[model samples]
Each structure stands twice: as C-alpha cells, then as structure tokens.
Target: MDRWVCRREKRRLAIDQENHLGYRRFYNVMWYCFRQRGSILSISNSSGAKSEQRKGKGSDRVVAVLERMGAERIYGVPGEEILDIMESLRKSKKIKFVPTRTEWGAALMAATEGRLTGRPGVSLATCGPGALNFPNGAEYAHLGGFPLVMIAGQKPINSSLHGHFQVSPLVSVMEGLTKYAVQIGSVQMIRPVFSEAFRIAQEEKQGPVSVVIPEDIAAEECEEDEL
Candidate 1:
C-alpha cells in the first residue's frame, strides 16, 4: 500500500513539472514573437519610405483611354480571362464597372445606352461563351443603327499550354455582326486599335464594334509612349 502511494505521488509530481515547463516554454516563445514584432514595427516606422505609385498596365491604359474619350461606364460579367481589365476598371474614378446578371443583359444595356445618348456605349465579356452571348445584342444594335463598343477577353496569346481550349475565332464571329472587329496583338496596339473602333462605331450608319484583348497582353506593363 505504501509503495503504491509513493508511486502515485511521484507520477503526480512528474505531471506537475511537465505542465510547468510547458507553460514556461510557451511564455518564452510568445515573448520572443512580441519582441520581434516590435522591432519590425520600429524599423518600418523609422525608414520613412513613401509608397510609390503602381506602374501603368495595358488594362490601365484601356480604361484611361475610355475615360478620356467620355465613356461613363462599362457593363459586363467578369471572368478569370478579364480579371486584369476588371481590376483596372475598379481603380478608375471616371469610368465605372457595371456588373450584370448575364453577358447578354450587359450587351442589351449598352445598346440601349448608346441609342439614348448618341455615343458609343461599351460592354465587356470574357472569352468563348461569354463573348458568344454578345452576338444577339450586336445584331440588335446593327439593325437599329445604334453605336456600341464591345470588348472581349482571350486566352494568353503567348501561351500554348491550352491550345485552342475555350478559344473560338472571336474576330471572325464578331465581324459578321459588327461594323468593325479586331484582336489587339500587343500592349502598344491598344490605344490606336480602340481609337479606330470607337471612330467606326460613331461613323455614318453606326453599328456595333468588337475588340478582343488577350489575357497576357492586358496584364503587361505599358510603355510610357503607348500610355
């Protein structure tokens, strides 16, 4: 009986010691973390470095040009392919991104806006199915002679990883329904190509126009001259 009691006491003491050591180790680790965090905060505060403006991207230039030319809003259903352009649109003060329930709904909204305002109304769509939805609205604008500008996304032009997957001949499909349809091949082509598209949309007997920008091209850094 005495032996069993002594063994029990020793086990209890051992457990107590282990618990105490664990608590001490935890406290030390927490103290070390707090000290490191304070040092990092002090270094950052003392450095006094001004945050630089983000570099301009092709998507930024696209939004800038549209804002400069008097587009008030762009209507679209966003997708991964157009994420860069959507981010650029999000940062614009003058041009707003108008989310719609469907790509077709966005196209119709743009068409109505163009008809009412007598200016080119812009709509955006992602590649493949998203872009395919615009033809009906484009036809409506074409038949009614309303000025409209439609922008569509494309797979990365430089990538062959997913060759022709989810990629249709957008330019060809859009051509039949629009006054002008062209794919932008590079960041440098954005300004000029869009300028021409806008011009064509406003020309005599105005109709819908389509412009396609590749996912990779839209995310590239824009040259100062291009911007």
Candidate 2:
C-alpha cells in the first residue's frame, strides 16, 4: 500500500510539473523579446524555444502559411493519417480545431462558418470514404457562393498507385464539385497547391477548393527555411 501511494504521489507531481511548464511556455511564445544578438528570444527559455524556431519543411510550412493568412480555426473530423498535421496545429495555436461528428457535417459547418464570417472555413476529412461524404456540402457551398477549403487525406503515393485500402482518385472525384482540386503528391508541390487552392476558393467564383493530402507527404520533414 505504501509503494502504491508513493507511486501515485510521484505521478501527480510529474503531471503538475508538466502543466506548469506548458503554461509558462505558452506565455513566452505569446510574448517574444528582442535581443541585441539580432535574434528574437522567447521569454520562457524552455520548449518555447522550439516554438520560436521557424518552420522549415513539411506540415510545419503548411501550418505557418495558414497562420500567415490569418486563419483562426479549422473544422473537421480527425482521421488516422492526418493526426501529425493536427498535432502541428495544436502546437502552433494559430488555428483552433472544431471536431465534428461526421465528415459531411464538418463540410456543412465549414460552409456555414465561411458564409457567416466571410472568411474561408477550412475542413479536413480522411481519404476515400471521407472524401465521398464531402461532395454534398461542397455543392452547397458552391451554390451558396461561400468560400471554403477542404483537405482530404489520401493514401501514400506508393500505396495509391498499387491499390491500397482507402485509396481513391481524389482529383477525378472532386473535379466538378469545386473550382479546384489538387492531389499533393510531393513536398515541393505543397506551396503552389496551397496558393492555387486559396485563389480558386477566394477569388473567381468563390466556392470550396479541395486539396488532397497524402499520408506520406504530410509526414515528411520540411526544412525551416522553406516555410
């Protein structure tokens, strides 16, 4: 009984320490300090340092770009493959996530949010089945003239061509549902794809633009300068 109690106490202490550190780190990131060394320093002087480090490659670049464009929230149903991107968003705190019960509901809510706020509402869905569920809401956004962005997770490129589970030809599937549909197969293609998608959704006819993110590509390590 004593051993168990002691273990419990240690666990509690660890959790408390973690919570304290997290709070301090958040504070520091929100309040960076200018230094004479020609570099900005984070106040907390801990893991917040990592937060100050500029995004170099991969999903980090994507999150930074979204933040730069002033996106405050993302509405979606979490999927297995996109969890890394989700974690990246959580760390940045630039975009809050609104998890919906269904993929279709996410799309509808994104459309409504976009219309009400007059800012693009972003939604994420897993590939294959998830993408299939989004067309209805995409069509509604199109008819209503709302600007929205939907990202669907796709199977890795290797698995995609060889026929893996949940693999589908997303570009062909979403072709007519929105003004633009792009399946990003490589890290080099991420920026152009994002730029074009944003243009299609916000300009021209003002409707949803779908960008299919493959699992392998989303997990790739992006260099800091690329962002």
Candidate 3:
C-alpha cells in the first residue's frame, strides 16, 4: 500500500512540474508578442501609410475612374479573387460596396439603378460559380435595354493551378450576355477598357457590359490617376 502511494505522489509531482514548465513557456511567448506589439500595430493600424501605398495602384485608379464617372454604389458578394478591388472600394470616398446575399439579387438592383439613372449601374461577382449566377440579371438588362456593368474577378492571368478552382475562359461566356466584355490585361489598360465599356453601355440599345480583371493586373502599379 505504501509503495503504491509513493508512486502516485511521484506521478503527481511529475505532472505538476510539466504543467509549470508549460506555463512558463506560454508566458515567455506572450511576452515576446507583447514586445512586438508596437511594430505590428504601426504596420497594421496606420491608415496614412496604407492610403499612401494605395494612391497609384491599378485598383485605386479603377476606383478613381469610376468615381469620376459618378459611380456611387457597388452591389455584389465578396470573394477571395477580388479582394484587392474590394479593398480599393473600401478606401474610396465616393464609391461604396453594397453587400448582397445573392449574385442575381445584386445584378437586379444594379439593373434597376441603371434604368432609373440612365448610367451604367455597377455589380460585381467573383470568378467561377459566382459570376455564373449573373446571367439572370444580364438577361434582364438585355431585354429591358438598361445600362449595367458587371465586374467579375478572375484568377492570376498566368496561373495554371486553377484546374479544380475558379479559373476558366470567363470572357467568352460573358460575351453573349454583355454588349461589351473584355478582360483587363495590364494597369495601363484600365482607363481605355472601362471608358469603352461605359460608352458602349450608354450607347443606343444599351445593355449589360462585362469587365474581368485578373488578380495580378489589379495589383500592378498605376501610371496615371485616371484612364
């Protein structure tokens, strides 16, 4: 009986020592993180630095052009493929991102807005299945002759890793639905591409226009404020 008690006490002591060591290690890690808090906060919390970094980016130029054209609202669902553009929208003073539950619902709203305002109403969709849901509203705009702009995000232009993912020849599918459908290939093309699209959407027999931006192109450096 005494031998068993001695063994139990030794096991208890070993467990306690192990727990104490674990606590010390956790405390040390936390202290290190606390020491790094200042630098981490400087990078993450500095809005000015972030704003400066965004000033001449391709995504920012797109935002600037849209805002200059009096675009105020964007309707759609958010996804990983379009995060840079989405972030640009968040930073813009004139444009606002309007979140919706369904892609078709957002397209419908954009269609209504365009019909009422006589300008291109903008809606967004991420690549693959998200963009596929847009045909309902695209068809609606086509039938009603309302000006609508559909901006679809796509994978990096050169990526071959999307076999099971969202990558596809999206512009081809959107071509039949949109009056103008084009994929942006570079930062310098942002202005011309969107200008032509907006113009076409407002022309006689106006309908939906589609613009696809690859992830890499959106991250490129913009040479001008407006295009």
Candidate 4:
C-alpha cells in the first residue's frame, strides 16, 4: 500500500512540473511577439542606400507597385495633380481609392486601417495646403505605431525654391513625423524611394512614410521596361 502511494505521488509531481514548464514557455512566447510587434511598427535606418532608388514612371509606378504589394484600398483626398494616378488606380480594379472629405480624415482612416490589418495603409493629398493637412494624421500613425504611406502632390521642381499657389516644402515638413520621406522629381529616383518607403512603413517598428510627387514629373513618360 505504501509503494502504491509513493508511485502515485511521483506521477503527480511530474505532471505538475510539465504544466509549469508549458506555462512558462507560453509566457515567453507572448512577450516576444509583443516586442516584435513594437519593433515592426517603427522606422529603422539600418536598411542602407540600396533601399532608396528611383525607378519606373515616378508616382504612377508607385501606385502600381503598391497594388502589387497587396494594397486593395487607398484612403485619401484627391486633388487635380493626383487625379491621374487616381484614375489609373480606378481602372486597374486591383485597388480601389476611397475619397475622404478632408486630407486629415484620409490620413486618420489610413492609419486606422493599417492598425486593424497587418497590411500598409495609403493616403493621398495634393500639393501645398493639401500636404500640410496630413501632418496631424502622420504624427498619429507615427506615435501609434501603425503602418501608413502618404503620397502628396508637389510643386514643379523648378518652382520648389520659389513659391507656387499652395507651395510648401512638404518633404521638410514631413521629415520628423515619418519613418521615411522622399520627394519624387526624377523618374530614375522613383523605384528606390518607393521600395524604401514600403520597407520602412512595414518594418518591425512600423510607422508612416511620405512620398512627394512633383507635378511635372508625374506626367513624364517612363520606359516600358521601367513601368
């Protein structure tokens, strides 16, 4: 009878130890996942120069690439300069554009969508005042650790120094609020900048990335291969 009791006690102790070890392992995995989520939601500068090259048809190319990257919807306020790209997206059917009443609203919606889904969210704005309105949303995404991509129309490169109707140095304004910021002026620079922007926004420390597209450049022709 004593031997039976001893054996039973030993089995109980072994089961208890196994349960304890399993709980500890689960706790550790949960902690690791949380940490990884935080890192993916911020900007990391370690990716190097290869991440920022310009390729394709500048802004148009960017839209195509975003669609290819699994972006089914874009939230933003449309303006004259960005209309062409919007039209293209509409026709593609691969992505749908959601128009917002205000640029700020668009930004907020994009950030919120990104938070809910693991995919990156996109917001668009026209140059000048339109671009200025997005900083608030951008800041929200940055602090909230959401993946967001902001595209803004820019004054022609020639008018960048001078002042156009709603001209603002958008790239400079968005610098601190985003993980990455690029002003797309040349066709050759679009691919690299876009690749980097997507990388930054989706990294382990996810945040916002802004791409400013110059007016003239957006209308320029891109080589067939580049497209």
lDDT of 4 by residue, 88-173 (tens): 67667688889899999999999999999967798989988888999999999999999999989876785545646777888899
lDDT of 3 at 66: 89
The C-alpha stretches of model 1 lying farther than 4 A from their native spots are 1-54, 161-164
Candidate 3 lDDT for residue 111? 92
Q: For model 1, what is the alpha-carbon lDDT of residue 140? A: 91
> In angstroms, how far off is 75's CA in candidate 4?
1.0
> Can you give the TM-score per candidate against the true fold?
0.75, 0.73, 0.74, 0.71
- Tell me the TM-score of model 3: 0.74
lDDT of each: 0.91, 0.81, 0.87, 0.82
lDDT of 1 by residue, 1-227 (tens): 99999999999999999999999999999999999999998888666342223457899889988987799989999998899999999888998889999888899899999999999999999999999999988999999999999999999888773667789889999988999999999988998999999999999998999999999999998654556
Candidate of highest lDDT: 1
Worst ten in a row by lDDT for model 3: 218-227
Give the lDDT of residue 139 in candidate 2: 95
- The candidate maximizing TM-score is 1
**Evaluation by TM-score, superior candidate among 1 and 4:** 1
